[model samples]
Target: MKIKRRAMLESTGLNMTPMIDVVFQLIVFLMLATDFTNTEIERVYLPKADAAQADDHPDKTRLMANIIHRISTESDCPQLKYKNGVLLQPCQIENHWKIVVRGEEIKTQERLEELLTIEGNLDREVPGNPKTPSNKPVMIRADGSAPFHLITRVLEAAGKALVWKLEIGAEKPPE
Candidate 1:
């Protein structure tokens, strides 16, 4: 008698449930890991420029200054001053628009004239072509809370100092 044999079939279906779950988990993880925060100055409104470019190159040898306007503890009026990166006591707070360089506080007309003369003398000492401007530019990282008047004053001072360029904005780290 002939023996009857049966053909065996194999299952070819693949389960995608685990893979889909993992992909969703990865998406959620990435979305939660990224954070966007702005470090704008407090209480001061910054003027917005519609035509401003997002990616501008920062000057390499730039001089930085911070302008702070606060109410004086002794007086009720607002006071302006130039502070270094850190708010140290050496800061000059007498006038909001004046800045000191090389141990001299430049504020009045006479002082400014003296300052310019001193700067000219120093520039003469450097061994280089007098016609060429300084390689270093002036970078003004004024607080958004700072007044426009103060910022303009800083720009004017930098110009008088023969700074190659003037840049004003908040500080950002390089990518």
Candidate 2:
């Protein structure tokens, strides 16, 4: 008895329709997820330094303050944006700097202090007493062109808020 083999194994091609649909779905999901997180953060051109290091608390709940210089925008510099509930529209002004936190611009140091204080107190069970020694960590991502006074103001506000665990975000200089 002669046994006949199946012809060409009936070449079954991969079903790409499901894969393409899954890929499109993933892209849509990522776009929405990234937009939510990024909208809260202002784009900052962090100062570069030799001592710049990687963040130790990558996943910690830390408040951020974005400081950018307000002047003419060059190829190297970016335009000043107003964080009015949403970081929208370019703003016109003379030589000055602006600070943004949680998509809201900190118009005054008092407001900065107030905002930080409120955020810092959120984790505390008691109004003034913190269960932990340190409140939430605060990071200041100041632009390279931003004035030193702006940075000082941010630091002062952080101090007023009693944020001891603070960090200045910087980029590593090119080797």
Candidate 3:
């Protein structure tokens, strides 16, 4: 007796439906998880002046202060500390910087004074050589939403403290 053979067929195409689904899911997840709150700060409209490029190089003993608008039940405007470009946690700077206001309102004037005091204290403690003006440069990284008035006040206070160099940390505007 002769046996008959059956031919089998094989599929050459790959199933990409599952892979595409996984990729789309990952994209959606990342988009939802990313935080974009700070993007507005980079879009601040800074006043234009004929002023030359200010020295941005931090002094050997540079002091950085990060000013941001914080929300609280008592005060909404609080001057927070920025150390080495990082925002410090609450009550982090026990001796260096302190919040002087309470309440939800922003106290632009008082914040300036407090910042100036901190600069003065730092200058006195960390003496710079005569070659470097104000041995300790005061750098301010204000939140994008913070009013220009607040920044101006801080600059004024810095001037009073004999701080010739004032650097504002900002991102380059998009082209």
Candidate 4:
């Protein structure tokens, strides 16, 4: 007796569920990762420089210190009222100036120094070594109209924290 053999062909399709899930996960991860840089940065008019270098590559562990200059809304100056159909300049008090770090406003220099010290100590030459200098980099982003004294104070704080690596934010002049 002879047995007959038959060939069976079935169509197979690729399951796209895993691929879609992976794509969604990657999108979420990128959104969360990029948010850190955006939140730390503040809206400040940077000084224009002829020799400003573009930051093609940025450090991930760099700390950002933003100095914002704010004009006082409640000023005692009578010039705030329109005179001769022209509005005068509002009072820009030094007390209105504030330093922001990591989306938190730093009211006092001592607190700012303490924050910087803690961040600096996160990455030291010797692990958990307080005596060694910090390997962390810091960037100062100050408004063009901001007072120089404020920048000086930030410098002092950074120096005290032993964070030697520093970068000043500047914008290139429009051609």
TM for every model, in the order presented, reads 0.38, 0.61, 0.38, 0.67
lDDT of all predictions: 0.47, 0.69, 0.51, 0.78
User: What is the total number of backbone clashes in candidate 1?
Assistant: 0
Ranking the candidates on lDDT from highest down gives 4, 2, 3, 1
For model 1, how does the per-residue alpha-carbon lDDT over 1-175 read when each residue is reduced to its tens digit?
6554442344457988999999999999988985432221222222344554453665332334445444435763333322433322232343543333333444554554345434433444354544445445444545554446666666565556555455555444234
Could you give candidate 2's per-residue lDDT for residues 31-94 as a string of tens digits? 8777454454577667677887788645445688888654445543355444432334433343
On lDDT, who's better, 1 or 2? 2
Better of 1 and 4 by lDDT: 4
The better candidate by TM-score, 2 or 3, is: 2
Model 2 ranges off by over 4 Å: 1-35, 56-60, 70-95, 123-127, 130-133
- Report the lDDT tens digits of candidate 4 across residue range 53-88: 897777876789998754457645442233443334
| Tens digits of lDDT, candidate 3, 1-175 | 6554442345567999999999999999999999664332222223333443554553544555555444444742244544554445333222222222222223456665555555566555346432223535566665544446556766776666667667776655334
Report the Cα RMSD per candidate: 13.2, 8.8, 12.1, 10.8
On lDDT, the stronger of 2 and 3 is 2
How many clashes in each structure? 0, 0, 7, 0
Cα-based lDDT at residue 95, candidate 4: 72
Model 1 segments more than 4 A misplaced? 1-62, 74-131, 171-175
